[model samples]
Target: MDRMFRVLGFFTLAIGLMAFAGDLTEMALLFFLQTAFFVILGYMKFTERIYILLFWAYMFVTFTGFSYWTIFQMGLPL
Candidate 1:
């Protein structure tokens, strides 16, 4: 589980690097923050169930925010 968090942190860091290369500083910064968060979580010792719950909560929040932004914040073509 801890390994998984570290892997996720690395993945997000990669994404942040890519975004930075693309000159999307805001997106890069967001991913950088996420990378930091996952890395810190990776170092912390927690129960298996707690890790699962935490991952699920993170997914829920991310998906909900993405859905809301796509639906209401973004300007899409009809």
Candidate 2:
């Protein structure tokens, strides 16, 4: 379990750096990867129900925010 978390963390950090590099493709990919990583991590820890719920909530918000940001960048309406 610890190993899994470590791997997820590593990927999350790597994706985060790539996202920060200002490439839209990389940023989108990173957001997806990080979101998946968090979901998996949350599921693996069965004892932490609250954490899982929170992580899923965060994922939902992140996805929505990204979608909105993309639409706005494309000059679309809300």
Candidates' TM-scores?
0.95, 0.47
Give residue 20's error in model 1 in angstroms: 0.3
What residue runs in model 2 are displaced by over 4 Å at the alpha carbon? 1-6, 17-46, 76-78
Question: Of the candidates shown, which would achieve the greatest TM-score relative to the real structure?
Answer: 1
Tens digits of lDDT, candidate 1, 1-77: 98899999999999999999999999999999999999999999898898999999999999999999998899577
Off by over 4 Å in 1: none
lDDT for 58 (candidate 1): 98
- Candidate 2 residue pairs that clash: none
Error of 2 at 68 (Å): 0.6
Question: Candidate 1: TM-score?
Answer: 0.95
